[model samples]
Target: MKGFIEDTNYSIGLLDDTATPRDVIDNYIYEHTLMGKNAFFVADLGKIVKKHFKWKNIMGRVNPFYTVRCNSSPAVLEILAALSMGFACANKNEMSLVYDLGIPMENAVYTNPCKQASQIKHAAKIGVNLMTCDSETELKKIARNHFNAKLLLHIATEGISGEEDMNMTFGTTLKNCRHLLECAKELSVEVVGVKFHVSSSNNPQTYIHALSDARCVFDMAEELGFKMNILDIGGISENEAQLEELYQAVSPLLDVYFPEGSGTRIIAEPGSFYVSSAFTLAVNVMAKNVIEHDQHLPSAGKQISNKPAFIYCMNEGVYGSFARKLSEKLNTAPEVHKKYKDDEPLFASSLLGPSYDELDVIVEHCLLPELEVGDWVVFENMGCGSLNEQSPFADFEKPSLYNFMSFSDWYEIQDTGNTSESLMKSLCVPCFHLGEDQFCTV
Candidate 1:
């Protein structure tokens, strides 16, 4: 094991300072073929830290609790944890993961409104009391199971015009907010805050309307004799520009309704905005085929044009890390990395996953230079809501993941000499194998 480790270490040290992420990925693929059945992931931990700082600088008034459901890779968790970011967990497992990393329970918010009875009990037993509830039934369950729990009443918001809406499934309606608060008061449950999600839409009005709804809830909670001190503005952006828009729209409202020094702690649960651009996936091309479409002109009685389309099948598919395409309507395009002849014309092409299901197709009708088997196709913006949702299908194993960060960043985290070294130890680059079947940490 020592020799093998040393060999891997030597290989990594050989990389030049000018190496691009693609260079690291290409080298890793060439070295660890694993029978040509591996998919590689390059995570930029420094980028995640930079994003956290950027968020803090822009929305300094709002603390961020990273949604763990998006890219729950250990590397992602470690980086966020090192930054002292709180967590927004949807289930027991996510909470446990955070706890296992030695993060305090107070730093985690159980965001699922509808939870199992056992889950609520377990959270209480583990000292995680900050939870969200949207219904009277959930309030009753919490009251019976853990009366000391700190609660957030989740309010439903209007659907944004041009974005994915989540108002249908979760959130309590405004008409029912008063009644829910009354029930919480009667049960002696501590309803300390209001929470709402704008569903990652670009509409700035969604935040305005949602904030207005949250203010109404706050007013009702105050009337019900509860001290409302926390406001959870849920994730509502896909990029920094949209996040700034949301912040700009809601900043004035927060000032008006919940002024500074009012002791109202404002926090947000941003998942995609933090991790969407921090990961790059490199999938190996396993097979290829060319289909020629011939057009025959009736007057000429001969085929005048032959349009050949190339189809390249890779080892990872929709059932694996690319599942977001099917589940979340993600439209991802592939960038082919191959040495092309200047005269070689680009052709229409399709990329497919190595699955029997026809729905495993990744991208269709895209133009790319000619590629052969064993080549590589790279996809960016793959860090959000991926990897953790993957499954091994048709007896095919999941791809192995390799996390990366700049050497300077790794050394700084080490030099800071914080107790978080235990977590940072696992995030050190040069590959942490995160296959579905096996887990390895550096």
Candidate 2:
């Protein structure tokens, strides 16, 4: 038997002939038209973030901290504040992002253990109040630079970072932590609790093991006669399904170790899990031009087993918002769900984005529905996906929604022409929904 996706178009079941996947993208996303360029109302990166927050998956029993590095879009930051989700900032800039948005330092946790004087000073000034330390050196640095500062111990993942490894570098060994505790005891510094990341995989068991490790660390701190106020279970790839699994495995661990009134609170830092999969990255395949070539098999070009190289290009690249290289497994592969024409192949594995830079491409390889020139190819990397936190992509990025087909009325202008220079020149790029059916450009 074929898998559901392996079946004919009937598997997805189209409505009218015009209800193509492009149409679905049009319906879900808002778009604005520039004079020459069509500014597809790409995404309200904000709305998506908020919706994901309402998911309440953190069980809220655990203090949920938003990892800013995921999509630091001011749009996302603003919404997160409104939702009252605490922030897990990595550095001074990330902390500033939330502060500028008026989120009090009380709602934020500084997770990055190493920092410059400026970061230390900023944390003090804003009174973010909470931070992390891996070694006696970091604790000394924090204790010396500012007033009484509160911090979580940044424990290293098991076997994760090799020797010279931060595991030892970041968080002092159980033995060394006793030293730090002794020092903290003398200096009047505060060591709130322990934090660790099971980021190696989206596995629920990783979380179970991480919590167990944190428990052991907690016992070590207590043995040294130091009391912990909180336990940062670090973070995990928490989807609804994975979250449930985590809840099952972790809820019991918390019961055995933390015991509600036992004086320790569970905290989770989730960025990708909160925002990934909430929104999509839709781009036009600008063109689907093909280079005809004969098979270059070991047998040579003779007796051609010819194939069309279905190369594609998009405006977004590694520099744009695509992290195709980082997410070797979770990379956003483009698929042709519904096509504008039936003559087109029903499905295909298409590589997208202009490959001028290293893997600037969206999906190195994918199974798409079909293709054509000017066809708006939608990739699943935008909005919120774990891949965005990898590298260069963590920099300023913009993921947009182009309504080429279905939700027709969501545009400031109904018609788009190739004459425009800016896709969303009228308002900006992504507009806001003004009425039930229409939207105003940004």
Candidate 3:
């Protein structure tokens, strides 16, 4: 861990000086490319897909799909569909993104438990083979719109965060499950499966509990006289060290629940697990300042500044991949990949982000090395990378593909196409310098 720790040592090593965090170097290159104007990041969508989707590992059982609610860039979705993977779309726009990926209609699943008639109609229009619904109204909505649609009722992964509380919003109980199954049978709509999100936010049995919930739904489907043939586990199989537990818990049910003719297939949909840690976000130093406000006790003759003054303003902010800044599940555990200058160090209160806001702080009262302007930061075990769903867009439009601007038009850049790897290499080069490039090399 000592080798891994970048505990506080205040001198922020500059380019041609000493190593900073890899991301810091990355920031320099990107900012330089952006002509030192501070570039905000769109996701490096290709990075995660290449590393995580080993066809052999993913193909055997439990087919995987990309959750469109994650970062669904046109390029990334194209790659996903090219891999012959499936999609879990939440709404009309996401479903349209999946279709644009040219995914097979049967390969796409409408996973949102709630919907507008338009979304259902769009799914129906696209020939969506499967959908999930929790309430009686949702079931009827599907029936009214896409009569051919098969729905897997959403069950809550209890205590899951903001968007994932299917139990809070969807899912039917043992009794309600029976009723929903009855409705499906009456409509001749297949209730061939059930799906639930693993508390992907929680550790340990978050996956196991989710697997158990799938089994429970399976049993309920079986008891309801619905001979179902598929189970949709709406999260990834990796990242969390819980796959073996989940597989062990649910694998036996494969033979027990679905006999040869029973016709059930297991599907896993991954968003962050598939694409996170594949790329480092490229942001440049936007602005840097130390805010000051002193609390003075006049009679006591004491003064204190409660808020730490060390701050950084980057091109990226809460909107990008770091948007999970507010999610307790995402923020509870933050992993920083470190690159240090000196072996001996002094711990300081370390923090991160492109903001000077109070809650925007990344690390607080932590024993870590000090960092300053133009440094880069990337997370370790990055479940969701810097492309936050809420991250801000350009006040103007985005860079045309990978046509980012460099500080000096003098440096020659060979065309590498708009790829995450190429973009990473572009970010790795130390091109930004207020001084001559000859004087500084990282």
Say which candidate scores most in lDDT.
1
Which segments of model 2 are wrong by more than 4 Å? 1-34, 38-41, 44-60, 159-170, 202-206, 220-227, 292-307, 327-330, 335-338, 341-343, 346-352, 367-372, 385-442
Q: Give TM per candidate.
A: 0.87, 0.72, 0.68
lDDT of 2 by residue, 282-345 (tens): 5555546454434222222233234444556664555545553455554355645344565643
lDDT score for residue 262 of model 1: 86
What lDDT tens digits, residue by residue, belong to model 3 across residues 1-442?
A: 0010011111111233232234343544544554644433323333444544353253347777778776565445554564567888888888876775555789988887778898889888988868888777888888888878877777656553435444554555544666777777777677877776655443434545555666777787778676667777677645444455555556565556544455678787877766554334444344455544242112133333454343445555555445666674443332222467666342333354454566665544333344556554444433353432443454522211221223221112122232233223334433324444322345
In model 1, the clashing pairs are none
| 1 or 2, greater by TM-score | 1
Q: State the displacement of the C-alpha of residue 367, model 1, in Å, after optimal TM-score superposition.
A: 0.6
Model 1 worst lDDT run, 10 consecutive residues: 1-10
State the local distance difference test value for candidate 1. 0.75
lDDT of 2: 0.57
Order of candidate numbers by lDDT, starting with the best? 1, 2, 3
Query: lDDT for each of the candidates?
Result: 0.75, 0.57, 0.54
* lDDT per residue (tens digit) for residues 147-181 in model 1: 67999999888875655554768888998999988
**Regions more than 4 Å wrong, model 3:** 1-34, 40-60, 156-169, 201-227, 237-240, 259-262, 287-309, 329-340, 343-355, 365-372, 378-442
**RMSD, candidate 3, Å:** 10.3
